[model samples]
Target chain A: WLHHPASVHQDGITVEGLIRRSLEAKEFAYCPYSRFRVGAALLAHDGKVFTGCNVENACYNLGMCAERNTICKAVSEGYRSFKAVAIASDLIDQFISPCGGCRQFMREFGTSWDVYLSKPDGSYVEMNISELLPVSFGPEDLSMKKVLKIPNKY
Target chain B: WLHHPASVHQDGITVEGLIRRSLEAKEFAYCPYSRFRVGAALLAHDGKVFTGCNVENACYNLGMCAERNTICKAVSEGYRSFKAVAIASDLIDQFISPCGGCRQFMREFGTSWDVYLSKPDGSYVEMNISELLPVSFGPEDLSMKKVLKIPNKY
Candidate 1:
């Protein structure tokens, strides 16, 4: 398993533990449709861990990925800031990275958050959120000053 | 609120109740970034109700939409088929429809699933999943028989 050193590790758990959590989460995935199971584990700034597995719907558009669900659980529990997230998928041969939607979603939380993409073997490559979603649209773009205000002084 | 005559109305709840659930779900949205709150409610085949609101992440791509999250909750609870879904957003002037990704996600469950798009005032319009996402990709396309087998008998 190849490991890129994680820049911001949270909690006392080793990276292997985080990867294992993601792998464990995959068991709960409800992916009868695509049969592509994915799991994710989020490390909150407060040292709490949140994990989720992909849940597919009969309607393809209603499917929720493990990464997003993990974040949702974290947010619902009132954890906003995050240190890192590890994602695992059994699709071998290639690293399973977060989808574009997930990359953008994580951008809404922290630009420097570490993202670990892992294979079934627990080996992972690390990339920061900024690297995953460069030049992203964010909270600043939705500010009233930028969205509702005129460009120059009247 | 304008109500569409639902072809498959499960439970005795009026269509307005479903739309209201969608609107109510929007209250719990964790959308500090976009400020565009959206809510969704799903009516399971068993007449159970599941609700969700947009949960945004620092990584914008990792955000979960109300529609998808509601479906995920239902599926996680062991419900497979759905009767209908209602979505509400504060964005006025036009009715808020599911995003392309959501349309595709919902398509995974049932093509004929009723999708109601509503405004805060409760005014809404209705369309089926097939209409929202025509010529869609689905499970049949990913079947192992079609994926791994040769086209004719050897």
Candidate 2:
């Protein structure tokens, strides 16, 4: 729930480096419609960094966000635990924040990890996943008992 | 847009076979959270079939639906145009319909493609993406001129 954290992340990587990689990851974006290229560099707990770019589809909702793509790339490669993820966009004035969907995707791993929202200028804002999605739904919610359903057909 | 199509698909595959593949695909589901396994078998115009199972995450929203997984798997392997997609679930009596997100995802390629919603007991229904997500937002919407935003900060 930080308004703006320090320049150095607790994970030992400089914010500038992660943000730079995220910006570089934008080169792989396949956005032909909106042309809003986004990139993310995810730091796995095992000391590996996975970079990903937004992959847009003709169906807007089917487009994969940069953050989620980065996470999925890591997960597909068998890296589940994350340390931090830095997101970058072309905006120079405003910091790039993750969409609600990406927030939930990042929260799937852990809440305490760092989320760096950066602009092309390298300036950034920081927040944890829990801050982005407060009072969130997690895996435990699915384990609850099913409620009664009315038999009336719609 | 269909309500209940025949047992035969226009692409030359039988409905029962596709549904059976979907059911078999469910065996690879990685849903440790919800335990609600779902599977999808996507048929490409080139006569290739790609199957995928739901891959859930600890964060509920991060869970990838079987439909999307199937699409991504196909896309990753260079199959773009889809002819049909059959979905299956363990429910014995009720057909398994795609969620709002999945419906939007399917509409990315085309609306006329077949979507088979099948149950464990072999009973099923059929529909198209147009019927599932009417008046859907798509890639074209992003090309419109941007609306002016209010300057007031919250």
Candidate 3:
């Protein structure tokens, strides 16, 4: 089973406020080569928040996605479970979903979590992780029996 | 600059052989997961050789390290700007590297390609799509002045 919770802001964190924060975080993007900017925020299970932005490098394959970056931030702080995630991008107005790699990493935390996408106007859409990763694999799929066993023994 | 090359095998390939094939691909793991598994190999990177393995996840803040899986097999396809990729698991000898995450996604392809992984006996591996992903997020990062300007308007 999975857990999902709603997302909202306190102390008057209006739509404009959220978008601005995303934009501010955008400045932190490390796209040395590719100038695309992406920012993300995660609402942790314990009520704390984590923020991140895209980081790029000269080697195209060495870059990290914004979604992954946010999750890594939360993990680095010792937060394993999540309640919601919010993402904003300079590329599109219509909300976009996390990349496939991001979705897989999200599953590792908990298959049932909420995700929010922000628009330039501050309006947003909400989704569940399961909706994004339907019929997916988890640690259970690699059961202990399956993982622990070897081919043969003497 | 990082040497991007190809990998190869001189055998008639058996299941056992495939596992070793995949194991060799694990060397260049970008795994932030700390669960290290190296899958490197000798190939013909335009007549050169290279290797790779699984890279783990990062919070949406930092990122999972990059270019671990597909690079190994990339050299084999003769494309060389990373033509393909092979994968191996970081688990105890019996596991396979290519997961649904690697197949349904994990961008490393020019055209169709081959994959390999290890088995329980250090004797075999598996093979599948070397060019697993088709559409990946490859965008040029436009600068802030370009980004802030509203698009398609006077």
Tens-digit lDDT track of model 3 for B57-141: 6653343322333453453465454323344454553434443344443343332444444433453333334322222232222
Residue-by-residue lDDT tens digits, candidate 2, A111-145: 78888888887778778888888998776675678
The list of candidate 2 runs beyond 4 A from truth reads: A1-13, A144-154, B1-30, B34-54, B57-62, B66-154
Ranking according to lDDT, highest score first: 1, 2, 3
Q: Give per-residue CA lDDT, model 3, range A24-83, as digits (tens).
A: 676688776655667887777766767789887778767987888989988998999887
Ten-residue region with minimum lDDT total, candidate 1 chain B? B1-10
The C-alpha stretches of model 3 lying farther than 4 A from their native spots are: A1-20, A141-143, A151-154, B1-76, B79-154
Cand. 2 TM to true fold: 0.57
Model 3: which docking level applies? incorrect
Clashing pairs in 2: A108-B59
lDDT, each prediction:
0.80, 0.78, 0.53
Ranking 1 against 2 by lDDT, winner: 1
